[model samples]
Target: MCLISFFSLIFFSFFLLVMGISYLFNDFVLFIEWEVISLNSLSVVMTFLFDWMSLIFMSFVLLISSLVIFYSREYMLGDININRFILLVLMFVLSMMLLIISPNLISILLGWDGLGLVSYCLVVYFQNTKSYSAGMLTALSNRIGDVALLLAITWMLNYGSWNYIFYLEAMKFDYEMELIGGLVVLAGMTKSAQIPFSSWLPAAMAAPTPVSALVHSSTLVTAGVYLLIRFHVLLVDTFIGQLMLLVSGLTMFMAGLGANFEFDLKKIIALSTLSQLGLMMSILSMGYWKLAFFHLLTHALFKALLFMCAGAIIHNMNNSQDIRTMGGLSFQMPLTVSCLNVANLALCGMPFLAGFYSKDLILEVVSLSYLNMFSFFLYFFSTGLTVCYSFRLVYYSITGDLNCSSLHVLNDEGWIMLKGMLGLLFMSIIGGSMLNWLIFSTPNMVCLPFYLKLLTLSVCLLGGFMGYLVSDVSLYFFNISYVNYNMSSFFGSMWFMPFISTYGVIFYPLSLGMSMTKSFDQGWSEYFGGQMLYYSLKKYSLFNQIVQNNSLKIYLLMFVLWIIILLWLVFIM
Candidate 1:
């Protein structure tokens, strides 16, 4: 069944590629709608919009997923639930396809919910404590987006239709539309792991690496960016767009810093994914939707290949993920090392590689744009940090002395895994140029000064130097561990975001609830109801016992005294 699905996706990818090319030239759309409900002038319909964008994105999703699945055949060879894994991958791909094609908010929810649920399942596929916690974080973070989409859908009820494609243009000028726009941007932030929601992406590395290759690298994380690109018409010139621009810039810088500080191989790659997501969000927020989408496609190819390379190395090393413990495998696993180098170079945006075509163009465009000082610094800083982390990763994992014990045998002999990686390797090599040509027939014009033109290259060189210095010499000899403990720990732990998101968000509220329960419900209720009642009853019973013994004797004596007292009272009156 897995084999059938794999080959079918490959064939379908080619078919969609052809269709996408045809649609690019002819500019035709295929729309299909089926009414599901109608009442009092309100109706709901399942709507699919097939255009070049959907076709192209769906093709890439399917292609990457198919390759990941094939790779998993070897990567997950000894697992007991391989079939379940394959099914989850297929379902994830299907959800992504549904997300790509949907034009109506209602139908888009189907795909959106599918992705959240399927990804949660895949994240917890390992059933360990780490996977469980990561899955909870992943699901809960994405649930915020789900709720936002639900609110946005409810708001669309005012327009009498859930077809967001039709409403985007007409609603842009409407003040009420900002509500939906803001909600949509919020949704995108959570899905893309922007700002407060950023911690989940790295934590989700507890899943199997094949799942990471698909979910983090391409389909799942990019869903948010793709949705924003689709909604760009409504977001242009809005406050929400401006807010997104600021938030995304911060996210890009934060993730790049986190990646540089990270030592785990998969977490580093995951942080890189977060950084690229921020780049996509930042570009889209700046109204360069096409450029964002272009980078999205190209980043997907190389990042998937990068994860696969990481997976191959991890498999060879008996599942060790710490880059600190890995070194000098370039000779032992030549093919895997070569793929890793190519992917890393592509990630660094080296000329003519997959990332260069989109990343360089994005930097040039940003440099030419009239951005704020903070955004400007973020753009360049994040760009340099990308190089820094790529060099850092290479220095630790590829070029250093071998750090493993003598007994462990490591080799790049997984033929099936290599086959899967080779497919994406080819695409990562050519995807950038191909996407650039197809997406931008006429290149964007940027009138930057000479210094700005060379800024990217210059910063890249500085980043490389800094990366090597930090990873090799500074890590060992720089006695700043005590001096810069707080600063180093802050960046190393992703600005304390995971702690803030998990414990900070939950702790106070939970403590308040516990206090309330103890003070009001348990403490007060027990005192008033049980203890007070019991004490009052016991006092009454003791008084009754005393009265019973003294009653007869006191009555006889009191009769004569009452008569005397009555006589005395009458005389006084």
Candidate 2:
């Protein structure tokens, strides 16, 4: 019950941090707590693992968490337990705060695991079946990542130096470091939902709009990308770094494949986030560390805004999330609809949006990565896929035949959420000009002209317009009763979602059946054919059964016989 508020938490964390920064700026041996783990704190105040990087990360953490808390007050005004919510928010922010400054392996793991575990609570805090499963799935996926990171730390200590700073420093050029680097990338892959890890993000749509806003859309999932940002120098020199590029490229395409077909309000955003993260990973693969972090910085702004706006829609529409059920709300709830659409257009990377600033820079970095020719293709293709899904999301959710009988003219959202969201949205629209292109983008790289970028938008726009023509054609062909979705029935999620509902549904049982069959075959083979001689030993002698099954006795006798022969050979021969 005794919990520090986010404001107080920020004040304390920052107070320690500012002192550390001042110490470092003054050319002193300044230190700060870079890691705290397993109830063990060096507790030396701000003199453990301090650095400018940690300081920068601290600043963004304060800003984002403050914004989320601000948004939470309005979004959850009448929440039955606002205090508990605030407590969770503080813990979430604190854990991240600890993570950014963690100086040791154990401390990093503490924050990493805590961040993942707390996220599940946030995702499922609403106590609904959908969000519960979604949170569980995300948590489980994160557990896989946690195991990899833990193993990596253990392996690093087993093989090299046990110290955290040493391993981090050694990894920069150690030829033997790829083993841990690969494991860390694997951990990143699962957390960021690259390729196979992509499904959990879409499933996480079961979360409340605000939780989704904070977790999947904003800061939580980006933790993986942030890890990449932290490890860029080490990874770029290893084979695993190249693997990151491929993984990022494939995830970008995968998101487009998933989101283009998804019509759910949150799922589209979820998939779009995945796709955008792929963009960040792709940039990180090229070793644009600061640019990747900047992309992450701006992405948090726009993604959080979109998720909050989506929350407003869900709260108003009696929790209906299907985009097809939300057409033309601009006429009824103009402010909310406009906010959501702006978020959508921003995600689509329309000019002037926060997404535009970040995405253009990411693509530009990819272009300038003199790493090789293939990298250019990967960047170009990733950009094309990015635009594809972004446009699809914007058009489908706002310009369709939306008729949800459950919907009411709900304007329940309070000032805190609106203020937080508007501040972010305004930045999403105009943050591009304020950014440093040279830091992230390639030096003197040729980018698409304004007309060409516009042309790309027009092509995507035409595709979006076609989507309008084809939205919910099922209404014309069949009754709602006939189209009633039985997600739990034989064909789950319409036999889509390649892994969970489709492959797992069929292949998991098939795998069990195959195992049973293998067991049966082994038993039969031993009894009748492969071991028939054992069963019918000695032509039906009474002692045969006992001898057949008694390997210990048989081996003992053989050993004695062999010893006798050896003694005989020495003595007689």
Candidate 3:
């Protein structure tokens, strides 16, 4: 299985290169249809749509999955279920491929549900309390999206077909189509972990690092953005589109704040993923679908690389994920540190890196658009917080005093892991520029005021300063201070979203149910049925007892009266 996975990796890399080059000269598309059920005016058909977007996305998914499989070989070396792990990853990749090629809602559901179920399996693979809890949260949260998609499929019945692509262009003005658009947005939000559904992304760190890298980066999270991109044409000038813009912007801001307060290395990265997803959704909500797609592809490259680097660090650190327990590892693990720095800088939109091409373009386009003050604040503030948390992470993990009591013998020596990371490292450096040239064909023209032009750089610099001040060794002296306690707690806990999702949503409902049971089932029903029947029977027995006691004297008098009455009646007759 390992050998097969390795060969598949090479084959996919070569194939992606060939197809990417071929796409530049001539675009190709394929459509295959099969009739399923047909009545007078109703039809249900299975259809596949393969275009440049699908091909590019599928190639990247394959590339990342292949590398993840190779990396897992070393990461899961002694595991008893290594074959199951590889098979699950393969299944995940296949499901994503199915989602990419399908234009029909029903077909998309097949892939969507496949991803949700397989991801649950992967999350719970460790067979521990943490994994089990995380898996349930992940699965159930995604189930909401599955339900939304099912509703969307049902609503499409109004149009007499299940193929959404055919109607996306024509249904822009149809009022009934708003329901589908709204449902799609709701479904996308759950899958992408936006705001109310955002808790699952961080909790999902319970999965193996490779699964985190693969699922969070490209397959699971990106699925929502891809779906939105597919339906972008139908969302223009719609109320749901504007609502999505607001929600996504807030999500971006929220995730960035959460990252700054996070300590776990993997969870911090996960929060960063949430923040970037928000950015993509924000852009898509603004009707720049192509820009969102461009960022999605670029983000997948660096984020997958970032997660792999974190996995290497965690492996070397004896599975300790807390950043506070780590320091000054750059001297021992140079390659891993190098990759980490590159990926982080790329995430911050550093120039010439893969992230810069998409991220910078996104910011420029956002600036040019006419937006309200709230969105503007969110866009820039989130950008600043990204750099803030990133530098703080670097300070804790890459530089500072060696905080470990006893250092384990560590080095950047895992050949398979390094090889896997190496594949994405170069792409993280050049992928953005290559994709920009291929997708845009020409650079976007921007004419902004001087202050606006310098806004991102200035905010980034300010955030870097704040990050340094917070991480400085002297800040430890102020530990006794209760300053900003509530604020810090809020940010650290992701605004208590996990609590709200679990306790707030579940606890109150369950509490209400218990109260109802006590009031109706145990209280009212018992009183009205059992107690009332018992009391009525007791009264009847008392009446019978009184009648028996008085019956002897009353019987004799009644016999005399009865005889007299009979005599009078006979005379009258």
Candidate 4:
């Protein structure tokens, strides 16, 4: 029954595409509107609509969602409440449908937050300590970023109409849109897990394989990229957008390091997601917005397939996540083994794979254009690192000795999951072959790189091969902490140290302290309220009592306190 509903969803989305396309290419303006309308309304959403960019985003989101739902039936099946899972799965798709189809920023936020909410529910559906904690981390980190976005919206709303295009038009940086845009970039960075909020992504491995496969690998992380692309006009200031590029590039480097060392199967994919999104931001920052979306499209295919394959391995092994614990199932699961190897190679940008076309395109754009010297070097290094880790992920999972003395994964998930990803595998293996026709041959106002094409190809191929050849050696090196001690030297781009440390010092201590302050805060909360000097906060649970469901009284009191502080600060200024 779940299988039937899932296929029905896919067929219905395709039916929507055919119906809309049958009449869309009528007139130029009509064609534009129809493109947006078809994508947003793919799930039968009548009120949802946008322009060409949104259409591109919507089409991929719909495709990934449908594929994940189809996989869920066989991937999880009897182990879960199939009916509820399917319903929630539909809710996930519906939320994304609402998010990308809407033409207004307000509608976009509703859709964005809704996507985050449903994803949390899905990630933590098992209600285990790990999943629950991961969900909470995701929620908390994203909510803080969401607040920044809300602040941007409020700032923008103080100026003009409540339409997305109004803000998008204003993105050209009129009189006051720059500050608001800068704020939006901050929110976008956090939502996209550029760096500070990126930790939650790896922890999200607690989610079932398909959810991790779809949300992190494709839809959710891409939301930030979409936001940046949507608001590119206001990004004229390098000083402002510079932050976006620096953060994204460095995050890719950081996460790729962890990927280089990580032993957990799912975390490897999580790290790849970080770098992939980082590359997306890199492209978007350089004004190649369409290419970023195009990269996103191809990434969704291969990454989803990769994660689903990892899930199949986990299910087969009865929930073993450590790659070191398994080996030599290739004979038993040759199809899966073959698929996994191709996905890894594609992920590392091997020839003709999905990643090759998209990844190489971004590289071409960066190297041939005004992409900064620092970004250029970091970009190449990061891709090399990506290939190394991609090799490790495949190596550790398939070639080692089996340690399944107590493990119990399903023999095979059969076709429900396999069918969902077969297309992705094929695409990852052959996507680059069509790049000349689909991408390279396109006529655009922007100039194409015509000279030194061979140098460009050499850089990409060399970076990838260097990564693959010594992955085993890199693995051993990472284990010895040689790299961690000299991380700053290796990455060498600390452009935001002053600001990141000023406000974001919490990450360092938290990463090392293991919630030391959390324990301290819990221990001191009673004393804080019990003291007569503490007239503001009530004496109760610090997080829950004061934060989650705080009353109108508390809000107003906090407002007054803020006003008083503002008055004092004004006098000092």
Best by TM-score: 1
lDDT tens per residue, model 3, 347-417:
99998999988888888888899889899889889988999899999999999766888758779999999
Of candidate 4, the 10-residue stretch with the lowest lDDT total is 27-36
Would you estimate the TM-scores of all the predictions? 0.88, 0.73, 0.87, 0.77
Tens-place lDDT per residue, model 1, 1-573, is 668878999999989988988898788899999888999877667888999999999888889988998999989999988998898888888898989999888888899999999999999988898888788888888988999999999998898888888878876778777788888888889999999999899989988999999998778899999999999976567778888889998999999998987889999999999999999998898899999999999999999999999999999888889898899888789999999999998998989999999999999998888788899899889989999999999899988777877556888779999999999999989999999889888876778899999998998889888889878888788745457889879988988999887774445656788999999888898789887899999999997887678778777877888999999999999
Predicted structure 3, TM vs. truth: 0.87
TM-score order, best first, reads 1, 3, 4, 2
Q: What are the clashing pairs of model 1? A: none
Candidate 4: where are CA atoms >4 Å away? Answer: 16-47, 400-413, 429-573
CA lDDT of 526 in candidate 1?
Answer: 74
Compute the lDDT for candidate 1. Answer: 0.89
Q: lDDT of candidate 4?
A: 0.70
Tell me the alpha-carbon RMSD of every candidate: 6.0, 10.0, 6.6, 12.8
lDDT of all the models against the reference?
Answer: 0.89, 0.66, 0.88, 0.70
Order by lDDT, highest first: 1, 3, 4, 2
Candidate 1 regions off by >4 Å? Answer: 37-43, 479-483, 504-573
Model 2 TM-score relative to the real fold? 0.73
